[model samples]
Target: MQNVYLAATSATPEVDFRFDSHRMSLKGESYPENAQAFYGPLLDAVGSYLAACRGTTIQIDVQLAYFNSSSTKLLMSLFEQFNQAALAGNHVLVNWFHDEEDDTILEFGEEIAEDYPALELLTQALV
Candidate 1:
């Protein structure tokens, strides 16, 4: 499958999914006017990649300064996909990065970790 890369805009985050390398990342803010339109293909791509791989290690990094409610829901769906992949025997690691003082983002990450026990989640505080 081809890799996916989308530049960040004022209302969305950057998407870098390198299927060949088994690494994906979403950075910057995400408040897209059409959350589904923005995330649908990405979720599909990930689903396809997971379906085709076995015993692979996938690393997902999320560094969002802010996201709207819709984005939050889509993000959770993305995490769920990874969680399912992990449950299916793939190694799925999720790195959630936030500012040291951003309690909100930290709490969100904690919530995700709590919800997706199968995922190896690492919540990191950036300086």
Candidate 2:
């Protein structure tokens, strides 16, 4: 399967997914007018990668500055994917990074952690 690498612009977040390495990273602010349009294909790619991985470990790193409600929904969907994959015996790990001074980001990470208890969610404070 092919890998996905999407650079973050004003409308989207940076998407760096490597199939061979099984490393996925998303960074930057996302408030796109069409969230689904931006994320749908990426989600599809991830699903395809996971399917072909055959129980390979998927490490996802999420670093967001700000996101709108639509992007938030997309995020939930992504995390849900992690939870399901892990529950199905696939090794999935999620790391949510936030600026140490940004309490809102921390809270958002915590909320995500609570929502997906099946997957291991770790919080990292940015310097």
Best by lDDT: 1
The regions of model 1 sitting more than 4 angstroms off are: none
Candidate 2: how many backbone clashes? 0
Worst 10 residues of 2 by lDDT: 47-56
- The Cα local distance difference test for each model comes to 0.94, 0.85
**Predicted candidate 2 versus true structure: per-residue lDDT over 1-127, tens digit per residue:** 7878888899788999887898889999999999999989988887777666657778889999888889888988888877777777778788999998999888988888898887778999999
Model 1 scores a TM of 0.98
lDDT value, candidate 1, whole model: 0.94
- Estimated TM-score for each candidate: 0.98, 0.93
